[model samples]
Target: MATVTESAPSQAGTEKYIPFETSVNYEKVAVGGAFENGRLESSWYKYASYLPHNVPGKQPPLEEFQHQDVGLRADPEKKALLNAPGAVFDEITPAIGTEVHNLQLSSLTSQQRDELALLAAERGVVVFKGQDFADIGKDRQREFGAHFGPLHVHQMGGQVKGYPELLPVYRDFTAGAVDNEIKNNVSSIKWHSDMSYEM
Candidate 1:
C-alpha cells in the first residue's frame, strides 16, 4: 500500500498541510489549453466566494495559482523533441525509440527508481509502447511486481493462464457491423474500467 506523508505543524502555531503529490509530468499538466496565455486573472466574485465576510472587515488573501512540481526525473530527449524545429507527431516515433534506447531501467540509481515508482503511483497509469520484454516472461513480471504489494486475482471470466495481472484488453471490431458498414467503419468500442465499483 502507498503511504502519504503530511507536513508537521510549524513552531509558530501555523497549521502545515501537505498537498497531494503526483507522478504525471507536471510540466505537461495543461499542455494545450486556454491558460497557455501568460496571464493571471480571476473574477472579483470568484475571489469573494472563497472568503468569509463575517469577521467584520477582514478579507482573505487572493488565491494564487501554483505550478505543479514536475519532479526530478528530467527527460532531455523529450524536452528536445518538444522544442525541435518543425517537429510533428510522426517525428516523435523515432524520438521515442531514442529515449527508450537511452533508458536503462536496471542501471537507474535508487533515487531515480524511487522517483519513477512514485510517478507510476501518482499517475495511476503509465504506458510503455514497443518494449521488447520477450526475455522477461510473464512470471518474471509477476515476481518483480510482487515486490510492491500482494497482487489481486481476477474476479470474472477474463483471466489469463498464469498471470492474473495480465488482464485482457479486447476490442471486438465486428461488434457494430451493418450490411455495408464493415469492421473498419465501426468506431464504437467497448470501454470498461480495470476494476469497477470495487474499493
Candidate 2:
C-alpha cells in the first residue's frame, strides 16, 4: 500500500499524501483516483479501459504481432542523434509528461530514435510541440514506430486514408462519423497504454 503521511489541505480539502517519488500527475489521479499496493497507481486506466468491454473487436493473434528484438541498436557512428542540441524537454510533473522542443521527429536517425525512446521511458510521456507529422506522412511514422517492434493498428479511431497502421490523432476541422466506442466508461482524459487490450 502507499505510504500515506499526514493529511494536508488543498483545494480538495484535507487529502492523504504520498511520496513524490511514488506520485503521478494530478490530472490523471483526479480523473481515475488511485489505488495503493505500495505505490500510487495512476496509469492503470490506460490498459484497464481498453478491455473487450470497453473496445469491441477481436484482436489479431499474438503470433501475428511483431516481436521486439532484444538486441536492437542503431549504427555506432550515429552518435549525434543521442545528444541532439536542438531538443529541449520541460517536465510537466516530476512523475509524468515532458514537453519536447525543437526536435524534428522526421529527421531522427535510428540511434537518435533509440535515445528518444529512452527519454520517453524516463519521462512517462514526451510531448512534441508544433510537429507537422502529416507532412512527415504515414510510412515514415510507421517506420519510426517499427523501430521498437511492429506498429499496432488501432482497433477503434480513424486511420489515414491509405495507411491502416497510422491513426490520425489531430482534430480535423470537419465533423466525421462518430465512432460507436464506449465512452461513459472510458475517458480520453485518462492515461492508458497504447493498445493495452492486446496481450
Candidate 3:
C-alpha cells in the first residue's frame, strides 16, 4: 500500500506525480474502456502491438488477437493489485514511456506478465527504478523479458557469459576517454531504438 503524499511536479516539469512514502505500487494504472465488470483495466487494451504472437499455445498473431478478442482471456479480478505498478505519465507523450512502481519482474503469473508486456507496448517504455539486476539474476532477467517475446541475441556487444540473449553494455573510463569512442564519434551520441534492429 502506498502512503500518498501531496502531488508534486516532477523534475522535468509541472506534471504531477503522487509521491509515495515507501516503495509501493502505483495505485491506478492507465486504462481504457471498462471490462465486463464495468471497471477500467490496465493500458493493456491499448497495447495490442506489443503483445506476443505465434506462441505454441499462448496468444496468436496481432491480427488474430484483435479479431478474436484474446485480450479478455485473463481475469482482471484475479490479478494481484500490489504486484502491478501504477502508471506515471510523461509530460509530452503519455504513451511514449510510463513509469511504474513496485513490480518485481522475477515473480509474476502468466496473466500478470502479459499485462506488463501490454503496458510496455502501450506506453512505448515502462520505467522501473532501483532494480537490482544482480539480485534478479541473469535467468530471471531473461525470463521476465521472455514474457514479451523471444529474446533478442545481439550481433554486437558483450554477451552475459552463458546467456547470449543478455547483452551487457558498459564503459570503463579508467581505460581512457578515447577507448569509449564509437566509430570516430560520428553517430556515437545518436538516439537509437532496439526496434530499428528487430527482424
Candidate 4:
C-alpha cells in the first residue's frame, strides 16, 4: 500500500510510494493477452514487429501480473514536438537513431511527451543529453516514467529499494561488495536488453 504526502517529493500526485516485498512470481509473467501452450507468451500488445515465440515464457500455473507499456502512443514525429524552440536534433546514424539536445526529459510538456514517444519508436533510439534523471529522486523518476505507460515492475535486477519501477543497472566492470552483488540477476554478466522480452 502507498501513503499520501503533501510534500514536494511526492511526484505521483499526493500518493507516495511506500515499498515492501512484492509477491510477484517472475516465471508466470506473460499475462497481457493470449495464452500459448497452456501458458501466457507475451506481456504487452506489440504495436510493432516482434517474434511471438521469442517473447519470454514461464510454464503453467503462473501468478497474475499487471502488464503494461507506453501510454503516450502517437504517430512518430506527428506532433513535431521535437522541433521546439532552441531544441537541436542530431542523428546517431543515418539509418536508426537520433539524439536531442537542449531539452530535459524531466521537464517535458504533455505534447512534448507525445512527440518524444513517436520520435523514440521511429528512431529506434533517442538519447536525451544532460538529463540528471536519476538524481531527481524516485518519486520524480516514477512520475516521469509513468507518462509513457504504467511502470513495469521488473522480474530480475535490483530496484531502488521501495521503488520497483526504478531498476538500478550497473556496469560491466566488477564493483560493489560481494554481499551487495549477491541478489538475483545482479551477476557481472547481465545478458538481456531493456524490456526486449516484454514487447
Candidate 5:
C-alpha cells in the first residue's frame, strides 16, 4: 500500500500582506473605496507617479502583488469594528492613563482617524506631529479632545487663555543676543508621555 500524507490546515487570523523588498509593506493597503479594483485607479496616482521620477536612478515599475490570496481572513468581529461608524471614535477615551507620544497624525486620513481614536483609547495618550494647529485654534482643539472626557490641566502654568485644558508646553529662556536661548532652540527637547509625572 502507498503511504498517504495530509496538509495541515491554515491557521486562523493569519493575514497575508503583500511582500515588498522595502521596509514598508505596500500591498493590500486599505485605500478608500475609490481603488477597490486592485489597481492604481484613483487620484492617489498623481502622488505615486512623482516618486519614481523624483528619485534619481533606475526604479521598478509598479506591479500587482503576488500571493495576494495567502493571508488568513479577518473575523466577523474585526471586520465589523473596522467598518462600523463611531467604533474608532470610541477608542480614544480609553487611553487616559496610558503613555503614548510622537504620533504621526498628518499621514492619517479621515478613515484612519477613527482607527487612531481607537488606538488612543486602548494605548492612552496619543501625541501627534506635523499638525497645523493654526486652523484648529486653541478652543477647537480643546473642545474636540473633550469629546473623549474632561480635559486635564497642567500643574505648572502654560494653559491656553480660555481653554485651561490646552497646555502650552513652556520652557525657560534667557536674554542673549549671541547665544540661542531655550525659546529659540529646538534642540534638547524632552518630550515626555503626558501625565507620567502626575502624582
Candidate 6:
C-alpha cells in the first residue's frame, strides 16, 4: 500500500517546528481545477472515495506473447555493446534507468541491437541523447523502429499521414473525434492509489 509521512507548516508558523525533509511539507490546495494535481494530506485508504467491488486483475493465456526475455537471453551481447572502445554507461538509479553515452544507435551491429534490447529490459528505462534519429528522415526512422519489433499503432493520438506508428504527442490543434469525449471526465476517473504508470 502507498504511504505518507507527517508535515509541518512553513516559515509563517516556523516556531512550531522546522522541517528536515522538504517533500513532507506539502501545502493543501483548494481550487477548482487542481483536484488531481494537488496532493491531499490523507491516508491511502481514506483518501480515495471507493473500495474495490471485485478482484483487481486476472491471468490470461500467454502462448501468443511468450518469448525468452532479452535481458536474460542476451547476456553475452550486453558486454560487446557496453564494452565498445568509447561506449559508456551511467546507471540512473540502482534499480531503474540507464544513460548510455558515446554509442550511436544508428550504426549498431546486429548483435548490438540485441544488446540494446537486453539493456533496456534489464534497466527498465534506458536514455540516450544527442541522437541522429531526427535527421535520418521518416523512412529510416520507421525502419529503425521496425528493427526492434512490430511497430505499435497507437489507438489514440495523432499519427503522421503515412506512418501509423509515429504518435505525435505535442499537438496545438483540437483533438480528433476519438479523443476523450465519450467517458473521460471527473466522474469516470479512478481516484484510488493503485500502482498506475498510465496516470
Q: 32-74, model 3: which lDDT tens digit per residue? A: 3333343223243432222222222322222312132222454
Worst 10 residues of 2 by lDDT: 171-180
Q: What value does the lDDT take at residue 33 in candidate 2?
A: 57
What is the Å distance of residue 124 in model 6 from its true position? 0.9
- In Å, residue 54's CA in model 2 sits off its true spot by 20
lDDT for position 179 in model 5: 38
Model 2, 26-69: lDDT tens per residue? 23533455645433343554433211222346546545555655
- Model 6 per-residue lDDT tens digits across residues 124-184: 8877777776566667778877767666654444455566666543311122222354356
Give the alpha-carbon lDDT of every model: 0.37, 0.53, 0.47, 0.54, 0.39, 0.53
Comparing 1 with 2 on lDDT, the higher-scoring candidate is 2
lDDT of 1 by residue, 1-199 (tens): 1223455544774433333322222223333422223321212122212212122232233234543333344342334423334322221121121122334343334344445454444444334333444335566556555444455554543434445454443222223223235446456233566545443
| Winner on TM-score (2 vs 6) | 2
Estimate, for each residue in 1-199, the C-alpha lDDT of model 4 and write its tens digit: 0113243443555442233322323234434545555433434323111211121343233345664434245534454465677788776555566767887787777767777776776678777767777566668878888887666766655555556566654321222343355566645443447656555
TM-score of each: 0.35, 0.52, 0.49, 0.52, 0.32, 0.50
Error of 4 at 179 (Å): 17
Q: What's the count of clashing pairs in each model shown?
A: 0, 2, 1, 1, 6, 0
Q: What is the alpha-carbon lDDT of model 3 when measured against the actual structure?
A: 0.47
Against the true structure, candidate 5 reaches a TM-score of 0.32
TM-score of 2: 0.52
Evaluation by TM-score, superior candidate among 2 and 5: 2
Model 5 weakest 10-residue run by lDDT: 68-77
